[model samples]
Target: MSEPEELPQREQRESTKKKKKTKRSGKKKKEQREGEEQVEFEQEVQSVSECVVLHGIFKLGKKSHDVLLTRTKLTWTPIIPENPTGETGVPQSGEVLLQDIFAVKVKRRRAAGQESGGPVLGVALFWCRRKGRRLEEDTLHLHNASSEHTHTWYNTLKELLTGFSNRPTNLKVFINPSSHKKEAVHIYRDHVAPLFKMADIRTDITVTERKGHVLSVIKECKLDEYDGVVCVGGDGSVAELCHALVLRAQLDADSPEKPVRATLPLGIIPAGSTDVVSCSVHGVRDPVTAALHIVLGHLQQVDMCSFSSHGQLVCFGFSAMFGFGGRSLARAEKKRWMPSSRRREYALVKTLARLRPEDCQLSFLSARKSNSNLFVQRDKDQDQDQDPKSEGEESWVTNQGLYLSISIMSIPCLSPHAPQGLAPNTSLANGSAALIAVGNTSRSEFIKHLKRYSSSTGQFNFSFVETHAVSAVKIRPCSLIGCSEDESEEEGDLKTTPFIHAEGTTFPWNIDGELVEIANEVLIRVHPRLITLYGEEVEEAESSVSCSCI
Candidate 1:
């Protein structure tokens, strides 16, 4: 009787254990089903194609994850056995845009646990990670169990990165090693060169020896041999390169042997006292950001203002100014030995030492009337339209005044001092320039207007200031000739003569932060989309605070 009872109890114990096992299996299957549902929903939202998905395992630190690669992005899903349905594919740690990929290399490592096997392959993926104020490079290494599998993954990644666009293969880089806090060389080696290497771009780097050395090198170089020209310096260096390229293109156009229509595009890697171009183009003052733009083959057409004095191309740039702006730059250039922290203040003080208005005659052509000549096609018909009589008005509407300054800007002149840009409303390829003119005013009032540049609502608020959208403008300095009533009657009896000025008085002109030669008159013409720069579209420009100034 005791043996029979023991047998019955053993049978019942076995039945209970079998039931528990079945319940556990059912719970696991439910969790897996829910996880799959979440992954399917995420895949649908991401628009990932199932046909081209490449699956692999990646270990980031101690956590292991399963990764899926699409043509444009990589998504990683965490492999959690206990809590499969808790979190799905997280974008923060999972998704990486293919456009941000810089390089994919195969790294070899010892296979510790494998028996009689050679080195295992690991994929080292390097990419640009944009953090608040700058870019940080981040790398991820995925170890593969087999060498062949690692190579396959690497090849797949390479094709995906290369398939975005026809990226440049060879480039000519000009670095100003002595400028921009003297970090140009270090920046190139540390940030820019590694990126070029990863993109498989061959670079021919030329370190600038002197102030104007880049111009000569560019003129002598066979520009066609390289895909693009890069300047690793400040605004001045970029301006120099721009002028050289424009002059070279002009020379080629006049050549009877080889006629070229456009010049090579320019890329700027910011390293200088003032990186206004880089600030304006990339919306940041980071060298790595500029390098990424170049590697990706992003091209943007920027407006270039052509300045001629006495039938000679005196200067050309995206931004220029005469009067107070020019005077300030001149003063700043002279105080180069001053500490960087005090240089700006010193220059500002010197410029304001004597508030003297310049006697000048200003004239401009309305861009609204003739937009084609400024942007698209400078046809013969447009030239005919320049005739004042044909357009039912004077070709050049002249204004005479005692002026403070005239700033001609084609692009948004962004700088550390002016974070919102000098011409915040200006567009990059728009065939027009912001012609801001300041009339003679009290020193206190001028100070008020100047102070507005630091504030969003105040820059355009003053009554003595005027701004226009112009296609072309000419400025001629003149001597103030005060005529008394008696002298006026002696000379002419009919009409009272107003105080007039004589022509030929000269002052400085600032072209992209560089002081140009003193000239009696300056002529600036706008060329719509004249040159292509490596940047994003004008539509992607940073959105500034909007305020209405009376």
Candidate 2:
């Protein structure tokens, strides 16, 4: 009886072992089926989402690749050869976004000394790649021996590029030969022209001969023929072009007082000493980047200020400065024989040495408070004390003081000197401008304030510094006799008279890096989204300042 019981126990143990093995095998089979289903589903989804535009085998480097083109991207997978053991290596793929591709051309091999005739080899793709804050040109060669194949790909790519409606097909380019270091022509020829040609953009280039040459040309030229205007120079050239464009637009609309929006966009290639406009707009003073922005159709609508004196329009500009800034620029203009950088430095030093406050009456219409942190935050107590009336009152805020420098900026005015911009609390287009007033302060304190612009914060933290979001501003400079007795004592005796003009008592003004002398009060009114420029909205600038003078 005991032997029979032991045999049944052994058989029961065997039965249990077999059932466990069967269960394990079923699980493995289920996993295999699920993996197969997953692959099938992925393939179906890919097929549904992407419509293959073209597929072919081309050589990338030494290896052949299976190239596939879709509406969104172009992908290439390396084709590995099978070994003698009937095993193939894993394929690696590379891809580029369709939008990144700017141009496609048929690669060719020509005989020595031959300029035009050549045999088609493959297709070459020219694309823009973002490297840090700049856009750089990159090229990829897809080698194929058939001319027909390459031409077909090229035509398809050309058609696709043409579909980008915002991209300019024709551009009117102006290069200021007298710009910083006189390299504008070289910059345009070497760096800018190739990119435009690659994108099949037709450009009518004009190398400016003298001051206001571009303005003269723009005034007479037919603007409708070109998609946009490109200026290759410094802040001054850009400012001039902006003024011309706005003036042209107003003339076209037959309403000089009621200005209209610019019809075409403006592109800036920085080749000047201080490319504040370019740096402010593109966040980098790079010609290649500017060209790429134009090619990619990046547009930024910018606010402009119409400077009017006694009801007559003085000019249209993005930024202007009075007092120290204007004096420095005026001195720099007198020393035209010196290098651009050295002249500016010398002028800065001289101006700082003789820094004197300009007694002026400032009045402005404040912008309504908003949630945007870009605007300067005013002290609640100060705001209430300055204006006791209700918030609904449209009365202008008035302030009278001896200011070292008064700046009104529609753009941030980014440059090597000021990384965050001279007016940090400003935007490209927000229907307002930043009005910054620096009350008379010690030279050391003023230099500290200027140096703070290169830092991340605290540029306007000092008690002497006042910043406001304003829709309009009026600046009226007063003679020395107009200053109060206490204010005059506080400011000390003036070293040099502010009135410099030989013909009349004219005050120097720096408008977008260009010096202008004006007599009497000037009214600056903000025009929102007045002109479209070829750049993306710059949210922040790279914190880097090259100037160490401050």
Per-candidate TM-scores read 0.76, 0.83
Stretches of model 1 off by over 4 angstroms after superposition: 1-53, 82-93, 110-118, 255-262, 369-394, 481-505, 537-550
Pairs with backbone N, CA or C atoms under 3 Å apart (clashes), candidate 1: 180-272
What are the RMSDs of all candidates, in order? Answer: 18.6, 12.4
TM-score of 2: 0.83
Question: For residue 543, what is the lDDT in candidate 2?
Answer: 52
The local distance difference test score of each candidate is 0.73, 0.83
Worst 10 residues of 2 by lDDT: 380-389
The sequence of per-residue lDDT tens digits that candidate 2 reaches over residues 365-413 is: 8765532233544322222112212235767888887789999998888
Provide the lowest-lDDT 10-residue window in model 1: 380-389
Instruction: Report the number of the highest-lDDT candidate.
Output: 2
Runs of candidate 2 exceeding 4 Å displacement: 1-49, 82-90, 369-393, 482-504, 540-545
